[model samples]
Target: MTVPMERHIARTRIRDSRLGQHNVRVNPGEYFVTGDSSVMIITVLGSCIAACIRNPLNGFGGMNHFMLPQSDEGEWNGVSSHMRYGNHAMENLINEVMKSGCRRSEMEIKLFGGANMYVGTSEIGAKNARFVTDYLREEGLKAIASDLGGHHGRRIHYWPATGKVKRLLLTGGEDSRVATAETTYRSRLAAAPVEGDIELFG
Candidate 1:
């Protein structure tokens, strides 16, 4: 019952950094990809999963934020959105870059977020970490960097063409916003279209 990624990634461009360059902001359950160097794709997360991937040769790169690791869990509003799932998020991002003149072997990957924001056995963060790790291994890919598993949130900045990422840990003033986001996502999960049997890690 998580919100669709497409809902958060609005087309309206906004300036997110001091460099004065145009950037796109992605909220929970959303993803963004681009080959444009000027557009810096950014997002904030707490216990959410986001994969930053790029192909240097083709200057194509992008990032995605997913709440669930798998897509076969259940449906939301009678629809199963693969984009909101980690597996599909990775698939979508990788395929787009590959189509832009990159290969799987040349792809550089970086992972972020997946923090234990709340106390629970769901361990969504850990599951997300495991999911990403397993997926990479299955694809025969290696990670250039990863900042995962902790009690804090993170703000990630990624450069697709260069495959460079800047991860800033979030604290203090960020608690409220992160809490709000978590609440929103959880509320959606509570409103599951399947009524039961669906598991959400957020």
Candidate 2:
């Protein structure tokens, strides 16, 4: 008998005096930013991508989760910054770190997630990883480490204060099922269609 599939949950916790914790489901085109000394966590599976960026010199960083490569014509909204895209995600991350008093030339990069969860489908994870690598080389940013392109989901934790990353694998195991369920719940909350002009965090 086929067993029921279990769910998964991805969580990121921050433990620094100068940092804050910001958690979000990170839908197709949404992104979140954490200040210096903070950390960001994003979980993903097939067809989705997340980029982790940090300034090693000053010990600060940020991450962005993007679903598609770029939006087609007639689908541009100004809710999230353009940096949410693979193309823009790299550029904007550099700019944000610079604005925080760090040099672009000294910035370091670490990447994770780009799983081909859907078997026999397009290699979206590989494409995403390529996009990020090309962007970094074109921009002259050094990539020190990476964990990309797989068939399983992943839970990634990024420390903006130190640029250190912790990765947790998610598989078809019972534990993974529970995590997946929790992730689904949180994703529903993050993807809830915004209502009439109301405060998001108020």
Candidate 3:
């Protein structure tokens, strides 16, 4: 499932004047990992998920933006399967962080994204939220915090080195943009059609 790093890694890195740090935007089907204290990883989500994991002791962490819970196929619309699926996204981020001398036992995890953009349609956001929580539990890991399952999108700013995340709910036209982005991306994937009423149990 390992594709070229260029395919999943965010290519654009800019210096944030306000934060005075280098920031990279992780688009859907992308993940970024860095140990630099001056680096920040950011992503926008709508019916998707991003797992921000870091080891406070060593100041090493990363973030992943996944579109779906899982995909058995090898690729989807030219997107790497590993980058688009939660299972592979989590595994890749963890492995990359671990490679930076961070231990799984010492990892500090925070979850974000998973917004239900379409009210009457599939509850893909809820499914993503449930998938990540369950995934962590099965791995014997726990998320320190999470923001999921709402009727809006989110813009996340994460400092992987420090494990500090700032979330901004998409509003106005921005919110519509996020939803449209997800819809466009989702339409490209060969997933099962939404049928019946999908609900998330608290």
Candidate 4:
């Protein structure tokens, strides 16, 4: 069987910074941090969500993406801490930001990505979004802004000092924030499957 062309192409990009940069790859339990940097960017797509947390008073921020809700199934082993599940990802991101000297009360949130990359798969994006909103509420934090839901992948840039978020949509091509085309592209991709695809096979 022939694999689809789209499955072999790169769909994400990470920017370089003079201060330094940290990149987190999917595996259900891996995380990276920029230390005291005032700005952080996290990109995500397809049944995935990125939570951007910033402490305006401290001028520090962090972002994390999780692919699932929680690792209750025990298939993730010990690395479950770094995976992009809703509950674990949220708590870990918050804790890490606080440990870097950010106070919970002083921190603001800007959420993005959680795209419904997969069609007819139980609406994972909506479920992930709900999990994030509920987690924030339970933790007594407020979301200053958000660009979530829909079927388009997003590239999210967050500035901690200013608590500003910039969202760029991904349509398997040039980057922009257009909603209609991106949504259509995502739907098409979700409906196709490739044989022997191992990118996320674990």
Predicted candidate 1 versus true structure: per-residue lDDT over 7-94, tens digit per residue: 2243546875789666787777667777676767778888787888877776677888866533355555554442235656677677
TM-score of each: 0.78, 0.63, 0.81, 0.61
Between candidates 2 and 3, name the one with more favorable TM-score. Answer: 3
RMSD of each: 7.6, 11.5, 8.3, 11.7
Give the candidate order by descending TM-score: 3, 1, 2, 4
Residue-level lDDT of model 4, residues 1-202, one tens digit each, is 2211111012233555775653333222234344334335455455466777755655555667665532233333353321324555667667655655566777778777666665476676687687778778976889888887887677665655466667777785433343344355445534433222112100
The TM-score obtained by model 3 is 0.81
lDDT against the true structure, each candidate: 0.70, 0.55, 0.76, 0.55
* Candidate 3 residue-wise lDDT at 12: 73
Error of 2 at 133 (Å): 1.2
Ranking by lDDT: 3, 1, 2, 4
Off by over 4 Å in 4: 1-30, 35-40, 69-84, 172-202
